[model samples]
Target: MTSISILKKWNPRPTSLSQMNALLLRIPVSSPSMSPRRYSTRDRELQSAKLEIENAPIIRNNPGLSASVFRNLSKFIRSYDLMDHMLKVYIYKEGEKPVFHQPLMRGIYASEGWFMKLVEGNRKFVVRDPKKAHLFYLPFDSHMLRLTLSGQNVKNGKKVLEKYLKSYVGLIARKYSFWNRTEGADHFLVACHDWVWFSCINLILMS
Candidate 1:
């Protein structure tokens, strides 16, 4: 199911290959389907990705890109395109502000906030249905959490963050069958905090 292979499965290929490519870009690797299995769409998407990666050609740059760099770079480029066309990300709606969806614009960690805002605002790669997404976004605003933690005891702050994340993830796991299906292999957390290592300790333990 490589993107190219998927395109070729149809009876009449589009006259404009580029247009077909563009349309394919909107087809996420995992999408809501009429299948009984939870991973039916995921499996299909994974097959497509695997085929696309395996079939990507190696572009020789002679003296330009080293062989190793070329291979890695090519893989990244091909994978990125496939992801753009087929990666569907779902942002969770649980939790309240100061920790949920608020973005911090004026700080070193603002990049994470900005990234979150952009993704949440961008509809091209986002879908309302969780079942249709390839990746699940745990939209915890670490920037806001940092601010709130500034006033709390250091040890207590860490525990608080861990508790919140555990609770949040637990809620999703219990309320929906997604986490239970894959053990959260499809879920991701977006963060730019220098302390992300410690902050994500809970996520690791739960995973």
Candidate 2:
């Protein structure tokens, strides 16, 4: 081939080893063929935000402020940016709707349901891939569980919910290594029912 033709076809390599190293660092984590070991840029930003929060002093507290409220506010301020930019929730896709994927958006339990839908709909924070998630949200609706138990003994209803949760957790543990790895430290659920909260005790202990 002519030199001009060769030049047109030729691909330039990194000028130096250092340049190559820098280029490699910028590679995206979503590359299908390669699993990157380093933290993503988003994760790095979150780490820096966390450090800033941890070191920040308690600023401008009112005399009426309760210690608990103050502590909560402090934490919120510190982590708000991190949560907005880096938080990723992975909602499991195993279960059927109205119990798993579907949540009631009206009535007393609406908050729980609305929150789930809101988070799931927010592309900024919702990541379908479990590998990319910061938290695993168990999308089971407590209100639906209660509804499922209508006309049954209240105690039996609790047992039914507990049983379902146990099986659900078992499925997750068997299907993925995430639950087993942290003993469920990274798993969480949102529910407004007292009974539902009580039913989760065993599930939490397994973590």
Candidate 3:
């Protein structure tokens, strides 16, 4: 079945978050497959960009800027140029509001929210096709997850947040072939919550 159809039929259980967590935890690790040779195009492009950056000449035109500040000014310039010209990101549309696809534009975590809004709406780097994407964005707000799941109570918040994130990842992993292709190596999340460090680490390790 098509991903869209599969997504439509698949439903998250409303019994409890713990039950959902149990189901998500059982999502098996997908075996690496070599069938999708189309990804090789992205690999080639990255290699080309890397070579170009490595061979780039030093930018001595800026008299005010010192080379000491940057490890390699030429490489940095080339990297930025390549990213601006070629980067394409695919955002999954399977998530719901407050936690996914919604941005929190206030408070200390505002940067993550603003970044999500900008990137999701961006035409230059965002692509609708997963095949053309160089990266995948998991658009979940950590702040919102905390608020929606745990509220003012902080007890076991870390575990709750981690489970929710894991469940989201599991959903996408099952809905699309992208996550399994790289085993989430190309997937990224924008989270700035204080507990993000530990939660993200646990998520990655568990995934």
lDDT winner among the candidates?
3
Question: In candidate 2, what are the lDDT values of residues 31-61, reduced to their tens digit?
Answer: 4222223455544655687687777666566
Pairs clashing within candidate 1: 25-85, 28-86, 29-86
- lDDT (C-alpha, whole model) for all candidates: 0.71, 0.70, 0.77
Candidate that would win on TM-score: 3
Cα lDDT tens digits, model 3, 1-207, are 322344466643566656766886797643343223345787678768878998998786557567666656778877988999999999999889978899989998999999999999999999998888888898889878777987644666666677777888888888888877777777888876646755565576457
List residue ranges in candidate 2 displaced over 4 A: 1-49, 61-69, 72-75, 151-155
Better candidate number, 2 or 3, judged by TM-score: 3
Residues 89-189, candidate 1: write the lDDT tens digits. 88888878888888777778888788889989989888999878888888877778767765666556666666667777888888988777767766787
Residue pairs in collision within model 2 = 183-207
What lDDT is reached at residue 73 by model 1?
A: 60
Tell me each candidate's TM-score. Answer: 0.72, 0.67, 0.76
What TM-score does candidate 2 reach? 0.67
Give the Å shift of residue 41 in candidate 2. Answer: 10
Error of 3 at 119 (Å): 0.7
